[model samples]
Target: MIPQKLEVLEQTEHKLVLVIEGISLEMINALRRIMLTEVPVMAIDEVIILKNDSPLYDEIISHRLGLIPLKTDLDVYKLPQECECGGFGCPLCQVSLTCEVSNATNAPLMIYSRDLKSNDPKINPVDPNIPIVKIDKNDKVIIEAYAILGLAKEHAKWQAVSNVAYRHYPLVEFDESSLKNPELNSLIVKMCPEKLFTMSNNNTLKLKDDYWRYCTLCMSCKNNSEGKITVSPKEDVYIFSIESDGVLEFKALLGQLFKIFNEKIDEFITNLEDLEIES
Candidate 1:
C-alpha cells in the first residue's frame, strides 16, 4: 500500500491534477500505468456531442452509446432546497429536453438534431409515456431520456445548475488618479488576452459584462493598469446542478480498496499462524 493519499484535484477539461504524497518517481510512473490500464476510471461530466456520428465506434454501438440524447428535469424543475448561490430559478441557467424514439428498421438513426427540436407543432409523441415511434411487434423501440453523466469536472457540465460558466478571475478596478497618463485607454485594452476591455465612445475604458466569461485570470489586466479600473465579476450569476457517473470520485473508490486490503491482510496473517508451532 502507498504511504500517503493521492490528492486528485479538478483541473481544466477532462484532465485532473493528481498530487501524490510520499511516492517515489518510479512508483508514480508505475501507479499511473496501473490506473490507466487496470482501473475503470473516468472523469465525470455532462455528455458532450463531439460528433453526431463519432467515427470511433461502429454504427450499432454508436446508436446505443452516443446517438440517443439525454434530457432531464434538473434543468427545468427547481430544487426545493435553497441553492448555495442565492438566485431564483432563471431559464438562462436551466433548461430541459426529451428524447424519444421507437419503431426503427435500422439501429442508428441518421436524423438531424436541429430539425427534431424546431418543428412548429412541437413535434408529436411529446408525452412522457408515448413512444417516439414503434418498430416491430416483439422488439418495441424505447426512448431513453435522463440526465447525462460521466464527464470531467472541468467540462461545462460541472456548472452550478446548468452548463453555464464564468471567469475565474474578474476585472480589477482602480481609481483614475493612480495612472501617470489618465487619458490613455490603450494600455488597459492591450493587457486583456481575450480583448474584453475596449474604449467607449465617451473615451472611458469599458469592460463588457457579457464577455467576462472568457477571462482566464492570467493577471495581465491587473499588471498593466496604473490606476482607476474597477475589476469585478458581474453581480448576477446563475447556478446549475450536476451529478457524476461513479467516476472522478476516485478517493471514495480508494477508500473501498483499502478496506478490502486490510481484510485480506488479516486473513493472510491468520493463515500464517496456523503453520507456526505452539509457543
Candidate 2:
C-alpha cells in the first residue's frame, strides 16, 4: 500500500505541533531524548527552498543540528589588534539577542548555544537578538537574552546562540499482557528493521526509550496471534509552543513536520510487519 503523509496539523514561527491520538508522556519523553541526542549536528543542516507558498519549504532531519551561517571558522571574526586584557572584551567575538517563551506545556524548553557561532562570512542570524523564552509557566511569560558570542561547548554559558531540535517519533504505549501468554518479546525485537528492540537479562521485553528515534511505528510489534499485546499512539494530548523573533515561516513549520513524518513512517513499517506475521 502507498504510504500517505498527513497534512500539516499546525505551524508556528519557532515550532510545529501534531497529534498522534493515543500515545504516552513516558513514550514521548523517551522519543525526545533519543532524537535530541542521536540526530547529527551537521555544520550546515537547514535548507530553505521557496516554492509556490509564501512560507517556503523547510526540510530537516531530527539528527540535523542548526546551520553554520559562516563559511569560515571563528578566527576570522576576531579583532586584529590586541586589547588591554589581551583577548578580553573584543568586539569581534560577540553579538546579542533576545528570546522569550510562554506556556510551553506541550514542548520542552530549548535554547541555542552562543559560543559555537561560526566565524564564516556567510553566517548570519535572521534576528540579531537571541532566543528568549520561559518554559512551562503562564501569566507574564519569562523573557531573557544576552550577548550570544562564545566558543565553549557543553558549557551552559555557550548555549545562548544555537538552535537545537528534539526527536520526531510519536509516543506509543503497548500492554504486552494484551498479546499472548509468555509474551514473546523476541517477536517485537525481530520486527524492527532498525535493530531498536533488545532483550534484557530478566527475560522481560520492554521498549527502550532510546529506540524511539528508530521506530517506524509499523505496528508489527502489536501483532499477537494469541492476543497478548496492544499498542497505540497518544493523539489526544496536544501541546504547542514556540519562541522566536520573526513571524512563522516554513523552516520552523516543515522542520517539525519532518519529525512527525519520521515517527509515522516507523509506525507504518512496524504495523505492516506485524500484520504480515499474523497473516
Candidate 3:
C-alpha cells in the first residue's frame, strides 16, 4: 500500500492550498484533473422567457443565466441521470428559479440574481450581484430557469472549482558560510518574488521556515547566489491549490474528490479482473 500524507497550508472561503506528500506524481495529477472536470455542481441549464423588455436577446439572456453559479447541496439533489426519475424533471433532480421584475419608476431598473426566487430555500445563487438584465420604465422582464447537478467535463457551467493545480514541493539548500558575499545575500533576499528569504542576525542569508507554502520553485535564489545555494523539488510530494466560486465548501469539495477517486479505483479493479489478457 502506498503511504500518503495531507496537510493544509492555507484555507479560506474560496481558496485552499495543501501540502500533499508520499503520493506519486501521476496520482496527484489525476486527482487535479478529476477535481477540475469531474466534480459536480449546480448551474442553470434551461431558461424560459415569458416576456423580455430588456435590450439583450433571449439567447444572450439565457446564456448569461446558464453561467450563473448556484450554491449546490449534494445531499439533497442528485444528477438528473442518476435520479430515480430517469432524467425527467423532479424535485430530487432539479430546482426551479424564477424572476419577475417590473420597472414602475422613471429610471431604468437593474435586475440582479437576488431577484430570482428558488423553489428550494437551500439552493440559491452564489453571488447576488450578478446582473441578468435591465428594464426601462413601464417595461417588464420574466424568466424561469432550472438548476441541475452536472459535471464540468460536459459543460463549464457545471465546474465546481477553478484554478485547480499542483506544483512540485520545493527544497532550498545552502550553508551560510558558503554565501559569504553580503551583497549577493542581500540581492537573493530581495529577489525572491514570494518573500521567502531574509537576512539572519549573523548578517547572512536566511530562508523562511515555511517557504514551501509559497515558493514556486523558480530557482531565483539559486541563480542569485551563484554556487552558494541549491534549489530542487522533493520527490513524491506536491503543493496543491484550488480556487472555488462558492459552489461547494472546501470540506464538501475535498470529500467529493476522494469519493470519485475511490469509485474509479474500484471500477478499475473490477474491470481488471474481467480482462482475459495473456502475457
Candidate 4:
C-alpha cells in the first residue's frame, strides 16, 4: 500500500489538528484507538499517607492523586513493567512526590495539586489549580506518592489524550446566483447552526472555512434552499483533532503513535511470514 499523506493544519503544545489523505477509515480509526489506550504516560501509581487531618480518607486522596495529569518525559522514563529493575522501584521507573500541608490559618485551607512536591523537577502536575482537599484550621495532611509510566488500558489516569477523534472532511457547495433574493440569503444564514455562511458585497453567499469542521451536515440550508446548496463529505480525506492531557506535547504524542503503529505492523508481518513458512 502507498504511504498516507499527513498535513498539519494547526498544532500547539496541547492541541493538534491535521488533514490525512490517502488513508483508509480503518487505518485512521486504528491510530485513534492507539492514541487513546496504547500511549504510555506518567501518573501516580502508589501513595503513602503519613498523616491526615482532612475530611477525605487516605484511599480517596490517593485516588484523586492518580487522576491528576503529570507532565511526562518519554525520553528519560521507562514503564515499570518494562524496566530492567524487575518492577521493584527505581528512579528510572518511578518518580517520588511528597505533599505536606499544615493549616495554621484561622480559616479553612484548600490543598491543591501544586502542593505536591516532586523529586524530579521535570515531572509535576499539569494544572496547579486542581483541588485535592480542604482542611480546617489547625489541621494537617502529610502524604508521599509514587508516579510511574503506565498505559490507559490499565487505568484512565494514564490516558494522555482527552478529546481524540477524526471525521471526514466536509464539502459545501451552493449556487450564488440562486441566492440573489435577500430573503433567501437571510434564511440561509439563520438556518445554519454553525453560522458558516455569510453574505458578500456582491450579494453572493460565501462559506467560511474556519467553522467547517464543526458542521453537523444537518442540511438545513440545503433542504430549505430548494436544492441550491449541497453538503457532502470527501471520501478519502479526514480531519483529525486531539487534545492532550499535558503529559506529552501533541507533536511528541503523534510521533510516538506512528512509532508504535510501525512496530505493530512489523510484528504482524513477521508473524504472517512465520505462519506461511510453517504451512
RMSD of 3: 1.7
Q: Sorted on TM-score, highest at the top, how do the candidates line up?
A: 3, 4, 1, 2
Ranking by lDDT: 3, 4, 2, 1
Per-residue lDDT of model 1, residues 1-279, tens digit only: 453554443444323344344545454444433333322221111233322222233344323333233332232223223333333323322222333333245454333333233111221221223222223322322222222322223333322222212122244565533443534567778768889877766556666774544665566667676435545643322111122232333354344335444655798899998886777
Model 2: lDDT to the true structure: 0.39
Identify the runs in model 4 with alpha carbons over 4 angstroms from their true place: 1-5, 178-184, 200-203, 209-211, 276-279
**lDDT minimum window of 10 residues, candidate 2:** 48-57
Per-residue CA lDDT of model 3 for 92-180, tens digit only, reads: 99999999999999999999999999999889999999988988999999999999999999999999897798899898899888886
Per-candidate count of clashing residue pairs (backbone under 3 Å): 20, 55, 0, 0
Candidate 4 — what's its lDDT? 0.89
Off by over 4 Å in 1: 1-59, 62-67, 70-171, 180-184, 200-204, 208-214, 226-279
lDDT of each: 0.38, 0.39, 0.91, 0.89
**In angstroms, how far off is 261's CA in candidate 1?**
31
Worst 10 residues of 1 by lDDT: 118-127
Q: What TM-score does structure 3 among the candidates reach?
A: 0.94
TM-score list, all predictions: 0.29, 0.26, 0.94, 0.90
